[model samples]
Target: MDLLATQQCIKISQEIGWTEKRTIETTYEMKLFNDYLLVKKEKFPVTSIFDISFRKKSQTNDIGFLYLHTNSGVRTYFIKEEPFSLIEAYEKLKLERPELR
Candidate 1:
């Protein structure tokens, strides 16, 4: 996993309601173990993750967001700059998680 990108994801998790202090201190990898997408500050548990979608760019010069559809609602993550890392992670999940495929 890209440490920098994963760290960015953790930071965003904190901004978006991740309150677990212990988790924040832990090193993260984009590993889909069991049913959760394990990250540093938060775990996207499959139970809570309803779907995953990619948004179209709002403008030609702009990138778009990766939409994490959850039980609560869709959470948008800025991923347009270099999205392949997260895409690979999700693809791994899809391969391992038959239901998601």
Candidate 2:
């Protein structure tokens, strides 16, 4: 798959804590490929992606979430930066190749 774009994001790993809820996060480069979305070795096909949405950062959360709703299930990626560019690119690719859908 050809690389279209890349976004820097965090991948969250939660742990139960007594004092407060805790999460371990790792930075990952999310690659937007011509035919798939790849992050941390997991790949999701562009055709399976049904929609994209943003879960805004709130008081409790420090970062926003980029949601990829796919035919199989939803994949959430944590991000501190704006995802408008990524969404725009994804939409454009999907539109350019409707046969993938």
Candidate 3:
């Protein structure tokens, strides 16, 4: 990530009370490897999430949607106008992992 994006992510993490442990950019800042994405937060176990979907949700701004399947259920996260970095990452992930499609 770039310096500005990294700063924004750090600010967001602080806003949400996250300690910023992982390098991967998830809702909870969990570590992610090529094989799997890790998610371990309060009220959540150390689970690996593979089911992920990204979509452009708004045309007015660089808004996007991230759908993730957790242990309990699927969750949706909205990416606000910030140049669509997450969407780009998702697209790259899709290219690397065809099974995600």
Candidate 4:
């Protein structure tokens, strides 16, 4: 599988302690392949993937949710920033290589 694009997602750990001001941020990669989407370690095949969506971080929302809708189920991943690049790349991949989908 050819790597098409990758999105960096940051998850800040919440802490409630005076000893540590803040916990270290965790990093995760959302990768788009020729026929699959890999979120960290788990991989979802393109054929099973139905749609991908995102929600911006707001006062109510801590970190936005990157919703991956698939045949199995909807998986939500916390993302610190907007994943416009990943979305664009995926769309382009679909346009350029329809067979991959």
Candidate 5:
């Protein structure tokens, strides 16, 4: 994994009020969903990872969505939106990677 990218993600998560915790080794998958941003992570030995979604439903719907899943378990979380500009960055990335667009 890219340490710099991970750190940037961490910083963005922090800005959005996503609780940061110390854990063992883990992996992450991030993507965009509609106007929302999704971040998923799985720790070693875990069959499934936690899915976190962030979006602005309204001017006041700053809270985002979070989904946690294990082999036979699932959970959800509602969190405040982050301050980092995800949509802007996504647009920039799309422009840079036209083939992916």
Candidate 6:
């Protein structure tokens, strides 16, 4: 896996939602292992940041990366690529993190 490319994809994913086209392009070479999409980078590699995965529920169509900023201790905004209803996304997140409820 290309580290630069994957980082770029992550940055973009954080800024905008991961569309079907972007997902295919970013994870084209990545191997799906269990729940995470595995990407191996060689140069300047600092572990995997995009290792987390999510399930697409029928209630939500909005898809994007969930970034947890450790340094700032704040949750970043969901970058949306295509137009989608965010209500379902919010519900899904709440369901995933029951503590937040």
Q: What's the lDDT for residue 3 in model 3?
A: 16
lDDT of 5 by residue, 1-99 (tens): 211111113213322236655433232444543333445552322213323234435555454544434344665444444524544554454455544
lDDT of each: 0.54, 0.82, 0.45, 0.80, 0.39, 0.32
- Which runs of model 3 end up more than 4 angstroms from their true locations? 1-31, 34-47, 58-60, 81-101
Residue 74 in candidate 4, Cα distance off native in Å: 0.9
Best by TM-score: 2
TM-score of each: 0.46, 0.76, 0.35, 0.74, 0.31, 0.21
lDDT of 6 by residue, 1-101 (tens): 32211211222332345653443333222222222233344121122222233333344435455343222243332333421323343334446654435
Query: Model 4, residue 28: displacement in angstroms?
Result: 1.0
- Spell out the clash pairs found in candidate 3: none
**Judged by lDDT, which candidate is best?**
2
- Cα RMSD of all models vs. native, in order, equals 9.2, 3.5, 10.1, 3.5, 11.7, 12.8
Would you list the clashing residue pairs of candidate 4?
A: none
**Superposition error at 64 for model 6 (Å):** 4.0
Error of 2 at 1 (Å): 3.7
lDDT of 6: 0.32
Candidate 3 C-alpha lDDT tens digits along 1-101: 22111101111332333654543344434333444443343232223344555566557555465566666688765554443453355446657766665
Clash statistics: count for each candidate: 0, 0, 0, 0, 1, 3
Model 3 has an lDDT value of 0.45
**Models sorted by TM-score, best on top:** 2, 4, 1, 3, 5, 6
Residue 51 lDDT in model 5? 30
Q: Worst ten-residue run, lDDT, model 5? A: 2-11
